[model samples]
Target: MKQPSIARLPRMLKLVLTRRAGFGVRLALVGAVFTLIAGFGEASAQAQTQLALKFKAGDTYQQKVTTRTISGGEVAGEQVKTTLQQEMLISTKVESLTEEGAGNLSQVIEQITLDIGLPKGKSIAYDSNQKEFSDPILASLHKTLGKLAGARFEFTTTTSGEILNFKMPAALTEMAKNQPGGGMMGDSLSEANLRRMFEDAGVSLPKEPVKKGDSWTRKASVKLPIGEVTSHLVFTYDGPENDTLERIVVSGDVEIAPAEKSPLSVKLNSTKLTGLTFFDRNLGRVDSSSMSQVLNVTVAAGGQTNDLTIESQVEMKIVPPKK
Candidate 1:
């Protein structure tokens, strides 16, 4: 088998780092996203219900998440489209509980597969489970993200699922430090970045108990590799779906601003985000959640402009442990 040209490796790596780094961030903190959305209602609500996350020592759960992003438009007056898809398996365990009932949680990525499809049907694919790569781009991605498999992140969160403190694995920091743009990558992996991406994007439960038909809105801004995004989400509690699960409806709008001191600038022409979460009060976990986002933006880089329409769909589901 003829190997891909070595000359293309640099451009490929840059493209992955610049355009898809947010997916890496998502892979890192997807567990927290699930946990936060899972604690929507307590089991004991008649007219009003308090929301809290419950965890038991030694309890463990798994989540399977799939995300797909498609962007199409013109780059430098040339038409282009790119599609990225990722599938990940993550495991979360309750290491212990605080005196206040908060959980000391640990999450690890078990498996991951990423595929990026570009115009003309050219594509790059990587799987952490794959051992050998004939293509240089796949080998590079394998070195960067493949190292993430089994990397553990530990954190403490309140009963409401608000993160208090987080610890990034030393290997991850070292991994970023070894990358081409190590400084920027390292900063992007900092606690501040993690919190902004994970916490700000998380579902913030109501401060007080909420009855059926109650609705609240939360606003947050988070920095991503693409840019800084401000989101406005309105959540409506639709009450219980059945005896065990509560359903919440989510809809939102998002706007993007270019990151300071970056060559890439993004102007959002229009954006929308919508989702639904099913929380199982009896299981104390979110059984399933799905979200979709569409962003229409003009990206300026190297004195050229790319008008793109990006659409993303994310679905997460809890995986039951083997008996």
Candidate 2:
């Protein structure tokens, strides 16, 4: 008997493919997450000593980025590229000081305007920008912030029209707590779990450690629907006291399939960080700085190998809090 076509495969096989596709997209998104957190962490760690680093106060920063996406394996046909120039303004106001460290931040606001340039033959066009794009985006933001804690505003314009909205989500408040390097559970982990894990790791952050080449590593098993995935995260610090986070590297293998599923696997071997900068607490501005990283991803299925490359850069201005 002849083998059946892939389209005629069993439901279970189809489900496997669907899951793999979703996993691929998640992997790509993970790269972006790494970039954001790595940069955020370096800056936050360096600025930890800055006076009055409390909530209910506002600050603004500017970031410029140049990123490129390259794909192979199943995604070989598509080429993705974008250049982003943007500004971010953040403000906070304490609504009620219920307790010394536990008060409600009533007004938390963020304003972002980005100029996005897409590659030829690929463009984003929409009518009723507010209804089509702004609403959903804002809703997600608000849900992410909730009743108190985090808020944001996004406005975008094309030659065609404009987009504007606001959102507040409580989860953002939690994420902000880990600002810079907290991973997946940074936003959702309970305080008790966080403390327990920190203690288990024997992690002790100094008020000020002599700035030098410092590195830390962690290994953990993450439970997924398919199976348990082992993850390893490595953080590296390279910078003088003036600027911190010279580099960061993360490498790990995630089990994409089990004994019954297809013999497939996904591996992420990426080193995402090159240069970083710290905000001048007194100056309230992004000190001049730059960062770069190269990432490689490999996927194996049915004895076939697919690979991809991602390169990214981040440059930003440190500005003072509004008066």
Q: What is the lDDT of residue 130 in candidate 2?
A: 26
User: What digit string (tens of lDDT, one per residue) describes model 1 on residues 205-292?
Assistant: 6667888878888777755666677888888888989888898888989877666777778888988898988878776667888889
Candidate 2 ranges with C-alpha deviation above 4 Å: 1-88, 92-109, 112-120, 125-206, 209-265, 270-272, 281-290, 300-305, 319-323
Model 1 per-residue lDDT at 260: 77
Name the TM-score of candidate 2: 0.38
lDDT of candidate 2 over 1-323, digit per residue (tens): 99878697555455555564677776665566567768988987755232112223232333322233333334445555555443434343334332333223322333434444566644332222122245554444333233222243222111111111223344544655654323322333333332232122211122233234455555544333223444444434444344432222233333323323424465666545455444333433334445455557676666666675656554444345555
lDDT against the true structure, per candidate, is 0.75, 0.39
Q: What shift in Å separates residue 125 of candidate 2 from its native position after superposition?
A: 6.8
Best by lDDT: 1
